[model samples]
Target: MTAPDPAGEAAAALGADRALRAAARHSAGRLTALSVSSVAAAGAALAEPALLGHTLDLLLRQDPAGARWTGWCAAVIAAEVLLDAATARLTGGVDARSTARLRRLGLGRLLRTAPHHAARHSPGELSARLTTHATAAGGVPAAAVSAAVALLPPLGGLVALFLVDVWTALAFLAGLPLLAILLRTFARASGASVSRYQEVQLAMAGRLVEVLAGARTIAAAGTAEREQARVLERLPELGAEGRRTWRIYGATMARTSALMPLLLYVVLGVGGIRLAAGALGVGGLLAAVRYAGLAAGVGAVTGRLAAVVRGRSAARRTAVLFGLPELAQGDARLPEDGPGTLELRGVRVVRAGTVLLHDIDLRVPGGTTAAVVGRSGSGKTTLAAVAGRLTACDGGRVLLDGVPLEDLSAEELRREVGHAFERPALFGEDVAAAIAFGGGPPPGAPAVRAAARAAGADDFVRRLPRGYGTALRDAPVSGGELQRLGLARAFCRAGRLLVLDDAMSSLDTLTAREVERALLRDVRPGTRLVIAHRVSSAARADLVVWLDAGRVRATGTHTELWRDPAYRAVFGDAADPDREAAGRARAEPSSRPDPGAVLPSVPEPPGREAVR
Candidate 1:
């Protein structure tokens, strides 16, 4: 037999303790009841074999009390059955309750964490952690209780054997060390394999989720087979780990299956010899044989240990989600009713050692619109994210209405700043609900309709089967229509600061222009930060902030920057020789504000170009 491993045993003990603590925290009463019932059931079961032996012996001797012994044996058997049933019921309840608590806690933490931080884990991995891992962790309490109960039969068997014949009991105990070594080996070996298997499983699941989300892109690229291969690339690793775990378990069971029965036969042989020598009576011999079987059935304990190891492995994954750091919030609240004057002071953001934005200092005055324009990768989106506090800057600060953004509570921030994304996650129950989903109180029907009209979305929405009451999933709205609904939702809440991150990308030129005009006319007067890709969008803004390579290249009205060749190149002109002539003709300096200029009426000169 192999020597005992103190380190392995210690780790197993620690894992069991952690599982127990989690269970106790979530389902203390249920766990306690389960443990109690399981113990009682095991105790009653342990007494049955001995009582049967005694009853049989009494019948053989033709004793008058043999009938009473038989009756007592029957009573013990019935009690064991009832106790076992209660144990099963309590065990399931405890597992379910603990699993639910873990899932809830994990999901809550995920939702509250910052988007960039939450992005560290993929959607598939997070889903698995909440589902598969949670279910496995929930079984920990039941396994612990079952493991405790499994000890009783063997202990009782050993005592009964010793009382019947000392040599038989000694023979039974001689094989126990081998069983212990086998269990420890399997527990240690299978743990690593199981952990690896779960990781690979999540990797594949994450890949699948990404593929499904981008199915249209894959189809357009005509790479369905290639994508399928990419998704299954980790399948071999997963299978290898799964096979390794099963092999270890099977080997342990095989060795135990061989050794435990041998130990039982040895005890039986010893009891038979003692009986022949008249050192033990027939009833005692019978009792010794039954006790030997119970003592050597160590397979039950092996199964329980396997369950414990599985639970511990799953708990580690769940812990990662639960332990994620939630975005911090302050105790202060925004002051009552002020224009949203946004200021960014020396803001910098670095992700994975790549600078997304650097030394950004800008201010958007209340009631004015500022368009952030840049080529793809030029930090426009990052700036919008920082301005909205969707992600906190690595350095410096952003303030709204003279209060640092970090000083405001979550509720205050949400109530004061609103965002509309290019691809909005519209997951409300119905069309109207989707249009009034975030930040502020739900708007009444008139307000919802007005916001939709402002976004140029009312015509299409009213054509849906149930109009406002149509389920969002069943509405089958186009991408542009969906973006409009998201815009309406953002407008309905109408925070002090509104950020549009390419929110109008899907709309046609006419629809976008109408929506922009309506935004200027109908929305509450507040600060606007628009991340623009088109020259038309920049032309509509009161001021334009031009970003190049994570730094602010220039800031002024669009007409002023239009003369710079590089700035014109942002709208895809290499060098416009006539730009200087155009600037001289306008005779408008970049510094002066053109208060009378309304964007839609601004004439685009021939060869000067418009946003394509």
Candidate 2:
């Protein structure tokens, strides 16, 4: 159901006043043409009553030549056709622009959120927001404009009827209160159902996506029947909702359809008798009845319009996806300094009042490697995430190049601080493009191949038919291969902090070792937070952080921490013996390094495995 006089607000709201104001302003010409055509069509309808009355009076008086009446009739038909054709073309243009604006807004907003925000939403739902919802929005302008124009025929004819016989016009006015009540009730009830239906539609679509994605798994488990039943289970509710809507509409129309025809007769009959009795003129009687018919026609036309109203109501429910109050646009400029310093001071992360990490203070000197090793649920990944700024922490700050992470613009942080997730997302792009992903600039063949080789992905890529040009996309790719692709892409930029959040988790031992060595030896010389599970990867780290239960249990050089029982248990015999043995052998106590000042953990850029 639409708001009373919603056409006024709909047109006004859809009019300029957004980023698309320029585009909407440009579209004004086409919209004006559309309005012109609609007016012409309404004019044709209004002219019919006058033409019919004129032709009848002329023939009855025996005053018209046949050609004159015939010509007038032909002109009316031609005007109708021209109006219909022009209206369609102009309205179609408006629909195109409206849909385009909605789509652009949705995509533009998504572009503003954090890098991983898009990954968090279901792809199918995201697609529906842009496509299904957008498609529905297109019809709103057309139907709403049509509805607005529909009002013109009735109102214009009523004006003519009022002049002809004010008595008959009163009869038409008698049904006003009823029609208003009917349409108003329909708009509200149907609008609510429409919003609910769209929510269900999104839920069903998400289910479909899951079913499609896990088709292989479902089939392997012999659970296709079960999954299909799950989808079917929701269908009954949807079917019920559809059937319920149809019933309400069918009932409403049953009453109004009968009421409109009856109302038409009361006006026409009363006016006809008055004309026959010389109380009203013949021309007045004909025009007034015709106007009365046109007034009743609003009921028949708007009855069907209820469906379009419901459909748009469904679309607007999802308007927040794009029609948000604010669009996302980062204003922060890129930090001028390189990835010179990374520090997390007194940082803690909590979820639902349960502390996940506590009082973690850490630092990375520029161009050094530190391996964070801990058991599962030990906050290894969470700590790495803090440096990557993936999740916000409750207390503390993560800084890059001495600037707080939050203050740095998203663009600067991304360009200067590159991170690859363990389960990295490679969008629907080619293998080379995926590898060169967030890498600084568009890469050439030689650069792509060299980076892939360094990440140990070149040999496999060359085996494909198109080599660097081969499309990996979403068709299918091994986990290990995807990991390497993320790795190779990391080499595309330099002078950045490289955070490997279990980056090498999927790779085999030898491949993982090789990739880490390639990164340290040849990739960017930024500080690295190498989150790892295996002890061997930590062996080469200039500094080792042993995490346990979300706290920094120990932080020292690999050799210095070997003899610490807590560190030994997590890293085992892998810690360096010579340095730990001497530290244990030293009778003198050791003092902790200053958090603000140190050699900056800058080791010969020796690194280890990425986060697991």
Q: Pick the candidate with the highest lDDT.
A: 1
Pairs that collide, model 1: none
TM-score of 2: 0.82
Off by over 4 Å in 2: 1-29, 64-73, 115-121, 279-283, 300-308, 322-339, 346-359, 390-395, 473-476, 562-612
Q: How do the predictions measure up, each by TM-score?
A: 0.88, 0.82
Residues 440-521, candidate 2, lDDT per residue (tens digit)?
A: 4676777777778888988888777777777875335689988887877776544468888888888977787788788876
Candidate 1 has a TM-score of 0.88
Q: Write the per-residue lDDT of candidate 1 for residues 81-192, one digit (tens) a residue.
A: 9988998888888889988977887788888877888899888888888899878988887887788779888887888788878999998899889888998889899987
In model 2, the clashing pairs are 1-187, 365-600, 502-611, 502-612, 531-611
Q: How many clashes would you count in candidate 1?
A: 0
RMSD of 2: 6.2
Consecutive 10-residue window with the lowest summed lDDT within model 1:
603-612
